[model samples]
Target: MQGFQQSVDIQSLISPLDWVVFAFTIALTAASVLYGNSLKKKTTNEKDNFLDLLLMGRKLTLPLFVSTLVATWYGGIFGVTEIAFNNGIYNFITQGAFWYVAYLIFAFFIIHKIKSYQAVTLPDLIGKMFGPNSAKLSALFNLFNVLPIAYTISLGLFLQTLFGGELLFNMSIGLIFVVLYSMWGGLRSVVFSDIIQFFVMCLGVFLVFSTSISTFGGLDFLKANLPTTHFEPLGGHGLATTLVWGLIALSTLVDPNFYQRCFAAESEKTAKKGIIISTGIWFLFDICTTFGAMYARAVLPEAESSTAYLTYAVQLLPDGLRGLFLAGILATILSTLDSYLFLAGTTITFDLLPIKWREKVSIHHLGVLSTAFISLILAYHFDGNIKLVWKTLGSYSAACLLLPVLFGYLFPGKISDKQFLFSSILGIVFTTYWRNAPLPGFYAQIDELYAGIVATSMGLIICRTLANFRSN
Candidate 1:
């Protein structure tokens, strides 16, 4: 309800020890990138090089798989805290519960199928199933989905909060840091760095929640101080609004990050087990973050929801612990940022480009740099509305890709490639129209995600009927 208000002396909140810890964590992450580069095998074959760079030679161990998957999935940490601060456990239900369901769906139903495909990326898989045109269309949508704009904006906001600089300048610096490390070792670097970040992020949120309980008493304090709406199932939102979040969660079914991890896993069993294990970890982390922010809400009711968790944690944590917490937040953002940047790069080089051009040289590094530059521009353009960036882009991916990708995988030859392409285009058209154009009467209440999905489903059904009629 209140606008973000800054402390007059923001730098004073952080002690010298805290800065040391933050710097050490960042240096350690960069060191992991070098370590990943050391693990790269010397190969002149272009195909092997591509596999090594993007899929880590299809040898992702279970622990590394779990760690990377969990870390990459949770880049929008502040957005989660903001929602939890404002809406209490409802944040867990919408953001956490819905996504957990989606993860299980991927683990149980989709992992085996993905492992069977020889595709290098999600678009490659789409191309194998549908056609080149379909893959290119999906790549365009995948590029939008994996752009890292939201995470860049988050890092910018974090840096601005700490040092008080121009937001765009801070964003550029953060992007440069990620891009530099990411270019050297590719997904291996991203995964190794994620292993460190996964632990840091978990520890950071846990410390905040545990300390809050020690300082402010527990559920009793929250109950007595917070608004009743915070405890409600919908957190005072309409049913449609809550359901729209659930629909967006369906995007996980088609998420490129999930596909990449699954494709990289050494075996189908490892991928399945990794997802199952990561889901448990995610459950614990969500508890820590949601309750931690709820505690912030109770104590700092007027503080900006987006920054309340950080402000309250810094106020409560001791000097050394404060630094670790800050590092954890940065780790959370950077882990996802680098991963998405890599995904965008891979999409461009492997999925979007012609084979001859991509195979002639190592242009993956250039693609990553291009992605970072584009993300910096987009992050600045979006300003700081992380939620809007997520919802808008996420809607397009889910509405257009979910049904087609899932159904295509399940009932392989049933849907034609032309049908897949047409359905996706129809979904895009409806989503764009619903988001930008006013609808007449009751249709106005429908969410853009729903509009896109409905249109896509209709297109699929009509196409299938025509095919069947011709056969008859």
Candidate 2:
């Protein structure tokens, strides 16, 4: 099938009033970053400075944790909307419901344990529990996972849709902007910016959603116009595709953004409570976005799949409101971009680097710059296939790292260094191989997550069994 092409009237999408609102939103976001930097306290030692810069001095409260977590976690606004446009309520089940379950699971069973460790980065936790080798290997995977490539693509798409330009130019400018603010104050900047973005995003979506529903009725309208399959929970993709979404959701267990917030929280209780609260906010936000998507599909059935949400909102909302909605979409993307850029930098400057070197010098800004450039390249190469980019990366990370990381935390000493290392490497190999070249015939139906997870689990089991047998 041909990729979706933009057919919406770009000239009429925004008014001068909307431009002011959109510009104000951008200004507010940048101002918040500068303000965050000013809030940075003087630190006597390098360790204190590093922590203060990267983790907000490990003093995140419930509000800050929840806002930043919610803002950073949902960067794929267009992708989410695309699913909703295509599958209707199925978007709710796959993108919203399954993830809520994961969030709840993480909050209740895992948040306390994560916070108790007080580790700054996931690789640090991995190193402490496993070994240096395991830490470095995992850091490699984590860094690749946290790269802002997909979000950069989102920003590029946003800019292209709004300003009408070459993808490369929009992506470069967007990457530069994201890198500048991210490098300015690190995670402090990210969280502070997220605070403003969270509200803007909420307002933007709320306005568009309210307008859409007011213009077109509600569930009754959807049911009358949409196919019966649209009302189906699975959204007509069948069970296998839905299961893949669940596997993708499993990445939350090892998501660096989640762990970073957990480490940054003031107490274990804050982390748990913040996560629980964020899940609720996510649910509300999903309602707004999914509702908007259905309206978009109903109103403009032939519009570009990637830009349908924004195009429909722009078509329906007034000039200023259209601008605000665009701002919200931009904020959603920037929030995620800044967070991932910072985390990717930390992986380079803090996680992968030797402790002695990292303690003495901070190259986090360099790391941020580097990540933005690399992301720009990936975003360019994977310009049209943003969903594919997310799936490939998400599936690989979840399949390869999820079990080893989770087992490392839950079972602790039960998993040996050798077993963890073997399993993790095998998992990566299996995932990469499966993604690139699957087994022939009947085995081809099984995807990367299943193949990688099963291969890694079986390897770990066999190794442990052999070790036990030898000892006995």
Candidate 3:
């Protein structure tokens, strides 16, 4: 793999037009950061505004919520970085369908539920149902489940390829650029920039696909160049591994972003509409990306898996479009990253941090400090294969949080807080021990979602039983 990566010449990977597009992206991010900083509220007393710390004071609109959802999901897993990691369309395609259905569930079932709570964080929902302690546990669980680890792993792939010999400074500059707007403006900056990024990402993918097909001469070029199972719908992961997708689809129902977007919506009707629309967008995006995997396999057989999308864009697409594609990739990465930073910051500040500290920390300061720390550490995450961490995190998500969330919402007020805590512990223990049974290929073809369902169901039963027994 290293040799294949080493074989590709960096000079061949970049062109002049790509530079202009890249520069423009950097310029735009900077401008947006400056624009967002000006929005900093002037506060007299040094105190955290609970509403601002939690739900952005519920001042969200339709477009902002919609775009943020798009950005939040895109992550480094999409576009070329995905190709770079898995090198096949299987993981990408299968996951897409799983997410599409999940998004619908989020739209109808979860979004309105969270909106009703009017809490800024998912933990807040838990806090409402159980107690502050349950909320704290939920935040800690979610802090690890996000795409940050995956993005961190892929950061190496992008920096080494995108900047090559330039090394640390290259990655640092990119991180700083994202932090500029994201750390300061918090969700406000994250959402506004994300909207633009979604468009930029779309444009980049569109141009790269068009250019690749055109350069290779036509469909015949792609068909001729493709691998044996290149266009296979399931990408070679068998029925169980693939079917497990159905269960896995439910995992996002318990995600922090899902909860956040629900809180961001102006009304139940708006949140409902926003989520339905977002799911539709996800379906289209996922399908197109699967096609992209095939195109890359055809055009750049020698290209590293991660470089598939970037390979076509940098070598095959015109320069200006190449730059746009890179910008889109950055957008995907930063959207997920900044969201985590903000969510995590809020967790430590409002949900998990001691009361005295929470009172002392201003929301703006909290956002800034947390962003800096996450960004700084994530930037240095130059080594290690990031995908495995993400997969593992997802498995953890299904195991630990899934059941508790289900119980929290569906069977609310049925169990004592202590009962819920014990159930969560049991679910996590069970998921940890048995989840690896399903491998990606033929063997343990389980979807992590079902594992989560089982864990949650068992936990719920235990919680209810305990509550019942206690009453008896």
Candidate 4:
């Protein structure tokens, strides 16, 4: 729970060789962006240009799809480490197992239906299913959901740890670097950069885990050194609290990044297979990260939980390998940050903008700039509490959109536009009230997301039943 600005001299722990490796990774990422930018020229048709910018011309192959999807989804790497440091294997269960289940659900039940809509964005699909008003409302929420605040904070923290400067200044520099590369090549650049980052991140965590095993032994070392609760499934948290994480994992069902990648995939089969393959990779990566953080916990029990894994890795690894690990962590965060920034910009340009205005000007760059500014502001406001950012934003998206979007697809035409809109509004109201208002005893124990989802469900049933009664 310690802030990201740790007092430890983290910069001194990093050697020159490590810096060389890190710089090399950044250089490679820049090269990839330049290559991606060179892949296509602007066409006469605005729609085609938009498609190329936003969806990579809907030509994402299986390998690209898997790498991009995996990398983008795991951007909050520091937050994952923080959870594992505090809660042990429960981190995998809450963050990993639940999300894997959600991924399977999306691949099997949702992707094909979404493809049938031929929508450019999640909000576009919402508009198609419900109405423009519904789409606009969903876009408003989606904008908030994809703010990149958490990843921005993670990047800022990483930079601060490396260069020893103001957190805000480091954050700004990192944001600018990503925007410079991402704005030109669009998702194509993001995808290509992600392919390199995907490998680096995997290797980084694997190196940490393997190094820990060699130095400190394995599970026996962890059990002997750490508290008994750390070995427990729930890590001593209450059942309700544990289950809420599972509910939060359901946010994956409504995640814009997943939707965007699926839309970008060359075919429905590619999308489905990509997710399945990515899940297996994610499972293995989770094992490395979760156990790696636990090793940190065991060795550095008194270190800052927010950064114990980083601290341990730098101190433990040899000079050159240490640099590579740091680069991997940076890659993990940058990959997610750029993708969300792009998505937020796309949402503004393609989904939120008035049609006439969009037709009159190519303001996608403006949208990206606007999103970067807003995300920087939010990242500053939240400081370094990545978990809070995730929980708060994930709760709103899951509570408001999950049921409506999923059920709207499953039982199309069964719910009217008015019903969808009202249900979503009800979810927002209930979530807001639950989060902000003082709740009476039993209600206080319930998560705001639970309240929001229940309210939305009730609204849907009431509206549908009333319409059916009137028809009869």
Candidate lDDT scores, in order, read 0.88, 0.83, 0.64, 0.89
Arranged by lDDT, best first: 4, 1, 2, 3
lDDT of 2 by residue, 1-472 (tens): 0222336666555778988998999899888878878878877887888888878899898888988999997788988888888888898888889899889989888876766566778888877778778788878888889988878888888888878888889989988877777776678989999998999998988998888678778888778767787779987776987888898898998888888988898888898888889999999999998888887877777877788888777777877888888889889998998899989988888888766667533477777777888878887788657778878888877887888778767777777767788887888888888878947996787788888889888877887789889889
Model 2 stretches with alpha carbons more than 4 Å out: 1-6, 360-362
Give residue 41's error in model 2 in angstroms.
1.5
- To one decimal, what is the Cα RMSD in angstroms of model 1 from the true structure? 2.2
Per-residue error (Å), model 3, residue 67: 1.7
Instruction: Give per-residue CA lDDT, model 1, range 1-472, as digits (tens).
Output: 2322333345788889999999999888778767877878899888787788888999899999999999998888888899999999999998899999999998998887777677779998988888888899999999999999999988998888788889999998889888887887778989999988988999999999999899889899899989898889899999998988888898998889999999999999999999999999999999999999998888788888778888778887888999999999999998899999999998888888888766433588888999999998888788788888888898998899999988898799888778999999999999999998978999898899999999999999999999999999
The digit string of per-residue lDDT tens for model 4 on 1-472 reads 2332233677887788888999999899778777777877768987777788888899999999999999998789999999999989889998999899999999999898889888878888889998888899899999999999999999998888777788889989999988877787788989999988999999999999999899889889999988898888898999888888887888788788899999999999999999999999999999999999998888888888888889888887899999999999999999999999989988898888877655322487788889999999989998889999999998999898888887888898887778889999999999999999998999998999999989989988898889989999
After superposition, candidate 1 runs with Cα above 4 Å error: 1-8
Error of 2 at 304 (Å): 0.6
TM-score quality measure for candidate 3: 0.85
* lDDT minimum window of 10 residues, candidate 1: 1-10
Off by over 4 Å in 3: 1-7, 11-13, 36-50, 78-89, 166-173, 217-223, 244-246, 359-383, 435-453, 469-472
At residue 335, what lDDT does model 2 achieve?
Answer: 90
TM-score: which is higher, 1 or 2? 1
Score every model by TM-score. 0.97, 0.95, 0.85, 0.96
lDDT digits (tens) for residues 97-216 of candidate 3: 677777787777766566666676777778888887677777778766642545544444566676575545555565555555555556666776777777776676667656655655
